[model samples]
Target: MNGIEHYRRAEELMEQATATRTNKSGFEVCYVTNEEQERLTRLANVHALLALSAAQADATEFKRELYRANGEELPAAQSAKERAEAKTARNAALAAAFID
Candidate 1:
């Protein structure tokens, strides 16, 4: 799935985690268990990072395209696509590390 999809899934999980129900004494009780909360937190974080990475990559590409359109020289370092990909990969790796 795409980054946006991941984000949507994370949002759904967050909603699930925060869901509540009325208790016998009219007190609110969280619907999710502690383990479910932890898992949802981890997954939400990972998906959020992925979404951010995707946005960064999109912005980089847009900037590069603008530069090319303006007849400006590309950067001497890595290409926009390469840099974006590297950044996204690093973010994903970090998320994976957290899960592990």
Candidate 2:
């Protein structure tokens, strides 16, 4: 799912969170609906980014770490352009997840 950028999906979650969050737990619970599925996908994407940030390890090791961290392992893809795109997408997702 490397090429499957979930950035906009994440933003959609933020919007939902903003719209539906009426209490302390509302925001947290809003992430589970089918309407917020993209947000969950984007969260997984950002968590994967944390694992992918390791520079010294090979792809398999990265995959292992992500799984160990309970995140999904994105498929093996070798291309600078793709990586750049993924990074951008992940950043957008992170902003959506963290920035509100």
Candidate 3:
């Protein structure tokens, strides 16, 4: 599956983890156990990471294509420091997005 597909799967898993369902008597109940919910959430996080990685790779390829099309030299690989900084920023943004 592609990045978007992984992302959609992750969303579905999260929804399943959090959604309430009606019991036999028609009262709303959380069907999932705490452990089950935690497991699902962890799986969803894995998928989200995969999606993010795929998106970054696609963006890099797109930039390379654009440079080639414009007859410009491709950009150099990111230095280790730059990569570390980017990772930190990405993690921070993700944490902010998930903040309650």
Candidate 4:
């Protein structure tokens, strides 16, 4: 699926995960366990990263085209490797948050 579709799916999952109930004493309770919630969040983050990657690629190409058309220099930005490393670090943090 496209990045935006992935992102939308992640949002839907997050909404589903937030579903809660009132306990006997009226305290709010999440339907899913903490581990399950963490897993969902991790998945959502991955989807978000995918969307970012797609959007960045689109933006880079658009900028390149615009610069070429105008005979101007393109602006500097993070390389794909740097972006991938950042995404990896984010994913690692998400995974670590749920570790025992």
Instruction: State the C-alpha lDDT per candidate.
Output: 0.88, 0.60, 0.95, 0.86
Show the colliding residue pairs in model 4. none
lDDT of candidate 2 over 48-87, digit per residue (tens): 5644543334566767888878866665667999889989
Best candidate, lDDT: 3
Regions of candidate 4 where Cα sits further than 4 Å from its true position: 24-27, 71-100
Worst 10-residue lDDT window for candidate 4 reads 10-19
Predict model 1's lDDT versus the native.
Answer: 0.88
What are the root-mean-square deviations of the candidates from the true structure over C-alphas?
Answer: 14.4, 20.2, 12.6, 15.6
For residues 1-100, write the lDDT of model 1, one tens digit per residue.
Answer: 6668878988987888788999999999997999999998888888888888888888888989999999997777988899999999999999999999
**Candidate 3 C-alpha lDDT tens digits along 3-82:** 99999999999998998989899999988999999999999999999999999999999999999999999977999999
| Colliding pairs, model 2 | none
Task: Tell me the spans in candidate 1 whose CA falls farther than 4 Å from its real position.
Answer: 77-100
CA shift of 98, model 3, Å: 45
TM-score of each: 0.67, 0.25, 0.69, 0.58
Q: What lDDT is obtained when candidate 4 is compared to the true structure? A: 0.86
The TM-score ranking, best first, is 3, 1, 4, 2
Best-matching candidate per TM-score? 3
